[model samples]
Target: MFGSQPNGLSTDNKMLSFQMASDKVKGILQLKKYLEQFGYLNYKNSKNRTHENDDDFDESLESAIKTYQLNFHVNSTGVLDKKTLSKMAMPRCGVADIVNGTNCMRSGKKNHHHRHGSGSPFHTVSHYTFIPGNPRWPASQTHLTYSFLPRTRSDAINPVDKAFQTWQGNTHFRFTRVQDSSNSNIKIGFGRGDHGDGRRNAFDGPGGTIAHAFPPPDGRFHYDADEQWAVGATPNSFDLETVALHEIGHLLGLEHSEVEGYHVSLHLYWSH
Candidate 1:
């Protein structure tokens, strides 16, 4: 489902050209969107579209691949090698990795004074990060009331409960499940594709994006119902507790960490 422009090389050891057939444009477009969404690539100048509506591998895409490689500690080559494709295929949260074009995950930038520096997203910090604005719950609002909406899965109930407990055990925040979603601090449920938040926040199917959560004050948590979800120790299905824990982290004002090999992006069934 993927092709590479591995042959393209520039005089200065950069990728000036690459290999891609017009026939492979479809998959490349998918890859393009993926990179754009996660913040590996962007198009600020419409006039300078490197690909230029064509199907060939271009400089823009190569740069995006290079950024992704740098983030994931892969080889700096801009080529879409087999390892790159394998990493991209992993299931991950729907959250954007680069908030406002600033990467939220990358090692060696450690700061203990603040989680996010400059009262904005950019931070010279450690592996774990927070949202752009660092929107955390109020100090007085440590106890958060949570509720499950109509599409809440039964198997997810216990796992979600356990996840909340895990959060409470570790942090000052406490979560309580309630029957009222309207008044709840966090609302969680299942949805498929464009559930309600609009097309921009739609779920991409089972393996691409398993779940998404809004930061503090906007407690909209959603899971892709099309996924094969399990409670615990189930084969060939993603564990609800695992994803629930990651999503819960978002609700508690934490963003995805830059730690290598430790992420919410995984298809647990791969080994099984």
Candidate 2:
């Protein structure tokens, strides 16, 4: 979304301007909504106390932009720059990186995390975090049963299987596939739009929100069926296994980290 102005913002000094604004009124508002949806903007703290057409670029909005920039390693200019917008448009997990005013992507120290390195004592300085309460399955429940919903794509079988295997290799969690849905602990499925979970977790077509999953005990994993999904990392198609592994981390009581793109290794920070 770009505005008619040279800097992609409105020339009218009535509202805050940015290069990503297509139409000063409509575009900027949509950007705020985007930020809000992914757990960025918190309207509760602001004096305006609204999520609508009020476009002032308030403190909360600027803070949200900075947090997003920090999570993605972009310049935390607090302004809607080209790099920020480009990243915002990319397809990502529907789960909010910031949950309940706590930036889940960046809450703890990277040095305090527990990880396994191949050669050195530490390979990555990546930070890891958990759900709000750190709810986890009992230590005895490490062997979990999983099954695919009937509506899930048939081709997802192998990729999902491999994803589970990868997790088993890295962590103590072991996943076993089952045919009977009633006897499974975790259920994986593909859905479109508001597929009965709720409006907050709805899938937006192909490129915006790709997939979402619940944290431990609530083991439902969903992928947006509208996306162009492929098994391995193929051209132009989203990798189902890669996403599955990330979602599986949620199922195992893990929140995504800032360094997710570079470090997908199992951190095993579970407190259970």
Candidate 3:
């Protein structure tokens, strides 16, 4: 995606030049798209702006870049610098940071009211304010079953088990590995490219997206087989346990938190 630069932008310039030229750059466009998911960029703001290419850079895009930089603790430069690009290049979860269109969790009927006050009806609120949708595994159902498909390596088994253990230790839910894949509630596996998950968000080969998992009732967790999966964090080897731990949270209906000053999602602490 990094081919043609935006007029005056160069590696030496150390930033993506914008505003002066209306020409589009692919890498900049990709950054814009990714930043939009985190609510930094607005699609509506750029809809009417005319550009020479699809991946156009503009004032709104610059503002969004600045916002992202500020949020992530990067230098608050309005241009796409090397540091910013590096951070954006890191492998990450396929699931979105925000869920259900709100920062906090939601529950209960949409129109049902018990006549408490002037508050909105149909809202079954959560005791915990941080968790979005208050969505979590049923507290009563403490035990859950899972299975590793044949594609997942034997070496990866122990790490996966350890990852599950970490989750169980943190939360009330327990996970048991079962041999029967069909009967298992959560299915763990390694797949390359499109592994037939029925969802359009398939594994993007090796380095891009490491893994993804479905929420709650559909606890289907899959990792990119192409990635260097390992127990400990090493060069070029992404930590299997870390990713699995995050994915397990998803299986339990936890969404990624947008709150700053954390390396990962704040939902990871929901059990506490």
- Scored by TM-score, the top model is 2
Clashes of each: 2, 3, 5
Better of 2 and 3 by TM-score: 2
Number of the candidate with higher lDDT, 1 or 2: 2
* lDDT of each residue in 1-272, candidate 2, tens digit only: 11111221222333335534233444666667778887888676676465445655555666778888888878888877766665676666777777787787688732344556564322344345777678798888999999999978888989889889977866788889999987799999999999989998888776677788898798899998887888776766777777787788788877866663332122222221
**Each model's TM-score?**
0.80, 0.81, 0.70
Comparing 1 and 2 on TM-score, the stronger one: 2
- Ranking of all candidate structures by their lDDT, best first: 2, 1, 3
**Can you write out model 3's per-residue Cα lDDT over 97-191, one digit (the tens) per residue?**
43444532222221221222233211232122323555556777779999988767887788789878876754568889999999998999888
> Relative to the true structure, how large is the alpha-carbon lDDT of every model?
0.68, 0.70, 0.60
Evaluated at residue 197, the lDDT of candidate 3 is 74
Candidate 3, run of 10 with poorest lDDT: 1-10
What are the clashing pairs of model 1? 8-17, 109-125
Query: Candidate 3: lDDT over CA atoms?
Result: 0.60
Better of 1 and 3 by lDDT: 1
lDDT of 1 by residue, 1-272 (tens): 10111211112212223343332333566677778777777777743366644545667777778878877767878877766776676677788777776676653332343343243222334235677778998889998999999868787899889878866755578789999899999999999988998786898765777788998988888888988887775666777887777787788767766555544363111111
